[model samples]
Target: MHTCAPPVETLEELLEAHPSINGNFGHLLLLQKDADDGTLSQALRPYFESAHLDARQAFHADIGIDLHPDAGDGDGPAVTYPGCLPLTTRKGLFGEVLAGLVTEGYPLVGEHEWCVPIFLFRYHEDARNYLFSLARRPERRRQTVGRLGSDFIGLLLDENGAVIRFIAGEAKWRKTLNQSAVDTVMLGDLIDDPAGGGARVRSGKGVWNDLNNDPPVPIGVRQLQRLLQEYDPDGYDAAILSLERALVVREPVPLPRTDLVIVAGNASATRDTLTCFLPFEGTPPEYTAGHDLQLVEVVLKKGEALIDAIYDSLWSENADA
Candidate 1:
């Protein structure tokens, strides 16, 4: 369990105070409170840009690779510019925002000491280019990779550096938050149980398999593995034991995992802006079974336009040049 108290007394206070875009897993009402004329954009721009840089570095670092300059001048490699607002860019931004929220101390899980969010994989053309150019993985050039896992994977750790749980996240930004939208964000059969005797015996393209297995673990998972091996090898064994014990604990045993859902859209009509509500209220039992869930809803006054506006403002210079 978290030993630290939350920074804000109430969810409303959290929405009003911090640059909410930079944080994770809570209700956020944009352009509603804090009546300052230009505060929102000013606060979000720097965080977004920095996060973009950090994400690129982290992704490369995960695969034991380094990025070289497109045109080196000897000072160092020039930053790789994501020149336009692609779908991947938007998805990456959402992951970074969620990570910021976790780093800023929003509890994504009830019984974990802290959650560290990582955005180390990309499933788009830009990432493919980076992988091929740097690692020489020509096979990955035309083949789709990195799409089989969660967008943001959070390492839920206890104070002793033992990973107690994992949070696999999926973020969606749309004008509507309806049933179809929720289904889409949930990633169809990816959330299904592999052992549950169905046509799909294999785990679909999702984080569940990655979290349960070794060798191919995500960057965040590897970090925890290293932490355990370095600090407490016994704790590592105990963690695995805990998971194994869950098999016989009950009929529907819960995995040491959580699902993080981030949904952003307009919500100006209702006065209740920062309330904790389940976005996947009517999701299928198979989709949500055996996992704890955390949801953060970002209600923008401008709705879907808010995302495009932020992207344009952040990338306009590069695009124009």
Candidate 2:
């Protein structure tokens, strides 16, 4: 017999109330019911479309990386609307979730103020392909580019609007919820320690490093710093100081950084998946870096098919109309 967990009205509440196995870390288990005959997608259609467009705009505004140059030319984003292409819709959904997490103030390493959905900006190749197709660049079609860093990187701020932490997050949508799968998804993209010590390090050299460092900064971090400088000079100074201190610190002191892992899959609600799945045994050494690590597991009854069904329903409803 399947035990019925408490019903949650919103995703934010679901994540917030999720049970954490480790007292030191946060974990959430979300078991989403199948969509209600297209009603849920219908209600969320506007938000999804808006989130896609807004995420694109934010990327352009912050990093000057415009996937669709003629997006807002009144021609409608170089893609179909009300029935966005599957990949475009997927990107939008991820961005929407990130925006929701930011708005809901999910705990991170700092006092958590605000966040920008910078993930899609880095990993979205479908938009680029669409634009390339429009430009008649067929040779570049379907060419996959490697991801530079984490799936999602949010610039977390303090109450004073000062940049306090950089939250690097990874989101995986799959049908499996086993231990190997969970660990692979969580620690796969993180920088591996060179000492062969089997330690997965969060902050390190290259793109994963602190933002306020000197020249040759990563494009995304550089854009964030520029945004702070343009909007809040004082906040910019704070970010610079934080970065400088990060470089000077020899030992692991409290720093503004976090690694968030989000896994969505199919699982039994009553089963104890946390202890078996995550690597959060007594006093995990991974958390010794003074950076917060959070894991959120979103369990869906229908698993991976849930999203495909919702999209199909959305398109079918639009077609019937």
Number of backbone collisions per candidate: 2, 0
Off by over 4 Å in 1: 1-37, 58-79, 83-88, 99-105, 108-111, 121-147, 183-255, 267-288, 303-305, 308-321
lDDT of 1 by residue, 162-255 (tens): 4466665655565544544444444334444655755443233332333234222334444334434444566456553433443343552344
Query: Which residue window of length 10 is worst by lDDT in model 1?
Result: 17-26
Model 2 clashing-pair count = 0
Candidate 2: tens digits of C-alpha lDDT, residues 164-207: 66666556655657765555554444566777798875433322
* TM-score on alpha carbons, each prediction: 0.52, 0.57
TM-score of 2: 0.57
The runs of at least 3 residues in candidate 2 whose Cα sits more than 4 Å from the true structure, single-residue gaps closed, are 1-9, 12-17, 21-24, 34-36, 39-51, 54-114, 117-130, 134-146, 186-220, 226-255, 268-276, 280-290, 303-321
CA lDDT of every candidate: 0.44, 0.45
Give the candidate number with the greatest TM-score: 2
